[model samples]
Target: MFSGGGSHACFRDCVEGVAMTCTYNFTITASTAMSYLCGDCPNNVSACSNPSCIAAGGIVRPVTVVNNRIPGPGIQVN
Candidate 1:
């Protein structure tokens, strides 16, 4: 599933000899905001900043690669 923001999905022409037109749509729910929320360390320690750190007894914090970003990267038919 995509993020709250919008994403661009392209349908490229394939050598299979088929049409390359595509269309897609979806709804963004309120939870989208929570999805990217950054949680801080338990004691506000800088060491434990993200969830990844918490795995090692660090902290629990939500992190977003790019705030307000959606769809992530891209896909090529090559």
Candidate 2:
């Protein structure tokens, strides 16, 4: 999930917004350093326009994980 369109723009604006899967376990006593910022989806490629980038060794955009879980038991169930 890479999104940063403030300077010029090359390839970093593919956001579906909403995804965290859940799975954390970090215990090291102390001494941390975590940072992540990517919020700029005015259009976000026309709201996710088909562009998975078939192949090329790299380039498979599509990331938006950050859910902490709360609506379990099959939400909506549809």
Candidate 3:
């Protein structure tokens, strides 16, 4: 859920200028490709004041299947 500061900052500034608080909604896709981009935050190049809000990991494991009907050699879920 990373938002570009350009539009967001402008919107926020506009709303705040009117003495109102702005509510922003965002969605983040957790995938390998988005690994470098932190979730719910701006680009890494730009410093995020509240760094704790960003997602820590973006890696997803591939589903494993053994043979045709059985689980893999060491596959176990608890």
Candidate 4:
């Protein structure tokens, strides 16, 4: 089974029946955004425009992500 959301848990028991092969294709590209909440913050708000707002508050910079996800997608097999 294949799942997305950047979870690290195993999903072996989530699927039933015979085992099958799963293939996934991803494209990497350069992207820019106003802000990306990398971690916990006050009231879940962020000021990416501020240069000082790094890490938890996120920053306005070039980022490379998988399938347009920050933590990338998750893959599971059984």
Candidate 5:
């Protein structure tokens, strides 16, 4: 997954061939944001100082990546 946020993360169980084409987009006004794939996420995530932070409190939500099995055999298997 791809994010326009300050930071991002990605975990690959198997990133072969066309799997790389898969992408996700997100917008974060927060100063610090995180992305996790396969549940592997950072321990700390800093919240934004913008007005949005005040409204939602000092809590930044990390983006989660859920990958489904590809219909066809992946490069690794092939």
Candidate 6:
């Protein structure tokens, strides 16, 4: 089990053929702005530092994510 910086509970390594249960909780919040490295703008590494950079195509649009991660966490079961 993995946590993306949020509260979570998980169970793993259960005995084979045994019954087990796993539970997870997530918080939903409004979208937030985030900056990512721009491959094409190597000369302008600080472009995303400005809040308005998103409007100028220097940053990605605000988005809602789980545990502050785009794809969230992963779980495995046996």
lDDT of 5: 0.30
Clash numbers, per candidate: 3, 4, 2, 0, 0, 0
Off by over 4 Å in 6: 1-11, 35-58
Query: Candidates 2 and 6: which is better by lDDT?
Result: 6
The order of the candidates by lDDT, greatest first, is 4, 6, 1, 3, 5, 2
> What stretches of model 4 exceed 4 Å from their correct place?
1-17, 35-57
lDDT-superior candidate, 2 or 4: 4
Q: Which regions of candidate 1 deviate over 4 angstroms?
A: 3-13, 24-36, 41-71
Using TM-score as the measure, what is the rank order of every candidate, best first? Answer: 4, 6, 1, 3, 5, 2
Give the per-residue lDDT of model 6 (tens digit) for 21-52.
66666655445444443333424656544432
**Relative to the unseen true structure, what is the C-alpha lDDT of residue 75 in candidate 5, on a scale of 0 to 100?**
27
What TM-score fits each model?
Answer: 0.27, 0.14, 0.24, 0.46, 0.18, 0.44
Q: Which stretch of 10 consecutive residues in model 5 shows the poorest summed lDDT?
A: 65-74
Clashing pairs in 2: 19-65, 19-66, 20-65, 20-66
User: Please, what are the lDDT tens digits per residue for candidate 4 over residues 29-73?
Assistant: 566534443333333555432432333224457777666555556
Q: Write the per-residue lDDT of candidate 5 for residues 6-77, one digit (tens) a residue.
A: 332333455556454444533333232332221222232333222222212223453322221112112232
Answer with 1 or 6, whichever has the higher TM-score.
6
Best by lDDT: 4
User: Per-residue alpha-carbon lDDT of model 3 for 1-78, expressed as tens digits?
Assistant: 334344444343333345544454433333332223335334453433333332333233332223211122232111
Instruction: In model 6, state the lDDT of residue 43.
Output: 49
Regions of model 5 farther than 4 Å from truth: 1-12, 15-19, 30-78
Q: Model 3 Cα displacement at 70 (Å)? A: 37
Candidate 4, residue 24: the lDDT equals 72
Weakest 10 consecutive residues, lDDT, candidate 3? 68-77
**lDDT tens readout by residue for model 2, 1-78:** 222234223323445684334323322222111111111222343422223211211233433322211111122111
